[model samples]
Target: MTTISALPLLDGTSIPALGLGVYKVDDTTARNSVTTALEAGYRLVDTASFYRNERGVGRALKDSGVLRDDVYVTTKLWNDAHGRGKTRRAFKDSVKRLNTAPDLYLIHWPCPARGLYAETWRALVELRDDGRVRSIGVSNFQRHHLETIIEDSGEVPVLNQIELHPYLQQRELRAFHAEHRIVTQAWSPLGRGAVLADETIVAIAAAHRVSPAQVILRWHLDLGVAVIPKSVTPDRIRANLDVNGFALTPDDHDRIAALDRGARVGSHPDEVK
Candidate 1:
């Protein structure tokens, strides 16, 4: 079993540095995957309203025999619910579906053109205040979006989930996050598995005798970036969390750094709206 460590968030709560992401997966698969992951020692499970599988995750968590408080659950508010009323209602629906309050709740996207993320941010703050969510954060937000929310609400998010991988390292945004004491969580941390077969990553994996996915995830861990790599395969789900054994070398970091081509496998934040 991997000894997953925790990263302290801005709100004085801690998050698991590596976790399972249930994006694009259906309910049955998400349920099975979450159950298997928990049985395999994974403590964090990431889901979202857009994923439409929160019920499955909730079911698995309840059935997994793991204490609810022992696992860190994160769910997101969808783009359509970017206002106080809808956001609150969406959160309530999510809680009912999950059968419990989430440990961390995030705004799925900034939707800047909608000009209502600030309202959604206030809703999240109120959720935190109401004890519906332990910590609140945002996903797919740029620095400007982050600043806007903080300026209006006087509250900074605990973390920011972004599309990050060796091929699309958001160095500037990462620096901004570091400066602001915001933990950077990587969605699509493997570049949607595009980086799994890269020559450099493969070479490192060969040296370490681990899967290329594990190598990339280990790289994220080394960089202090929290990762939620999505997979429905039981074996791959187990392999993704089996990354606490090895350490990447300086040369490995340089090789992976050289692979940064500013590529993205997900939508650009500014263009999402």
Candidate 2:
């Protein structure tokens, strides 16, 4: 099992730097996947109402015999639930489906066209104040959206979950996060398998006698960012967590850095709504 490390958030809470992401997997698959990941030493699990498998994630945590406090489970409020009351209901529903309080809760998107993320953020603030969630943050929020929330609530988010990878590195946003002391969590940390076949990454993996995916995951960790790579297959899940054994060379890191081409396999944060 790999010894994944943790990164501290602005609020003093810490999250596992490597995690399991259940994006399109069904509830049954999600449950089994979480179980497999936990057995492989993953302590963080990322889910969302948009994923529609919180119950499966919750069940796996319960059945895996891992203490709830030992695992960090994160879920997000969907975009439609952007108002004060809707946000509250959505959170309650998420909790119900999760069958336990989420360690971290996040606003899924800025949804700029709705003009309601600020209100949604306020609701998350209230949840944190109620001690229902250990930390609160956002997903796919740009700098301006983050500024609006901090300006309105005087509270900085614990982290921002975004579509980050070798491609679409979001250098400016990461710089902004570093300045504010907010953790940056990458959702599609592998670029949805696009980077797995990259010549540079493949070469690095060959040099290290590891998989290309491991090289990419290690690259994210080397940058001090959190990554949640999704896979239901047991071998890949285990391999993803098996990145702690090796370190990337400076020359290899530079070659992988050169692969950034501002590509995105997912939606742009500004246009998500």
Candidate 3:
């Protein structure tokens, strides 16, 4: 089994750097996948209320026999729940479905069009203060959105989850995160499988005798970004966590970095709101 290391938070909390993502995975598959991941030594599981599988993830955690404090669970509040009042209620509902308190809670999207994320962020801060969640963060937030929240809430988020891969290097945003002491978390570290067939990544994988997926994951790890790659298959779940053994060389890292095309597969934070 793989023994993944943990990354420290700004608050001195430790989170497993590699986690199992449960996006688009249904209840049955989520249960099996999360259970398999836990058994394979993964202590972190990422899910969202939008994914509609929190109940299954909850079930798997309970059945896996792992102590709640032993695993790091993360979930997000949806766009519609971006108000102070609604944000509070949303977290309660999510916790009910999760059957456990999440180690980290995030605002799923900035949803600036609705003009309520600042209020939502305030609510998250309240949640953290009230002991409902250990940490609070934002997802899909660009640097500007992050600035808005920081300005309004007067508290920096612990993480900013975004779409990051070899093709879409978010250098400027990452720099801002680092400057502010916020950790950058990669939502689609594999480029949604697009980079798996790339000649550069494939060549690297061949040289390392690893799969293309493992190669991409290793790149994220070397970059110091937390990654949550989702897979319903048991083999893929195990494979995703088996990324700690290999180290990418500096030359290999530069080769992958040059593959950046600035392409993003997900919706822009500004467009979504």
Q: Global lDDT of each model?
A: 0.93, 0.93, 0.92
For every model shown, what is its TM-score relative to the native structure?
Answer: 0.98, 0.99, 0.98
What C-alpha RMSD separates each model from the true structure? Answer: 0.8, 0.8, 0.8
lDDT score of residue 250 within candidate 1: 98
Instruction: State, as a TM-score between 0 and 1, how close model 2 is to the true structure.
Output: 0.99
Kindly list the per-residue Cα lDDT of model 3 for residues 200-220, writing each as its tens digit. Answer: 999999999999999999889
Select the stronger candidate by lDDT from 2 and 3: 2
How far does residue 269 in candidate 3 sit from its true spot (Å)?
Answer: 0.8
Candidate 1 structure lDDT? 0.93
List, residue by residue over 15-90, the lDDT tens digit for candidate 1: 9999999999999999999999999889999999999999999999999999999999999999998899999999
Among residues 3 or more apart in sequence or in different chains, the pairs in candidate 3 whose N, CA or C atoms overlap within 3 Å are none
Clashing residue pairs in candidate 1 (N, C-alpha, C atoms within 3 angstroms): none
Candidate 1 total steric clashes: 0
lDDT of 3 at 95: 96
* lDDT measured at residue 230 in model 1 versus the true structure, 0 to 100: 89
Which stretch of 10 consecutive residues in model 2 shows the poorest summed lDDT? Answer: 1-10
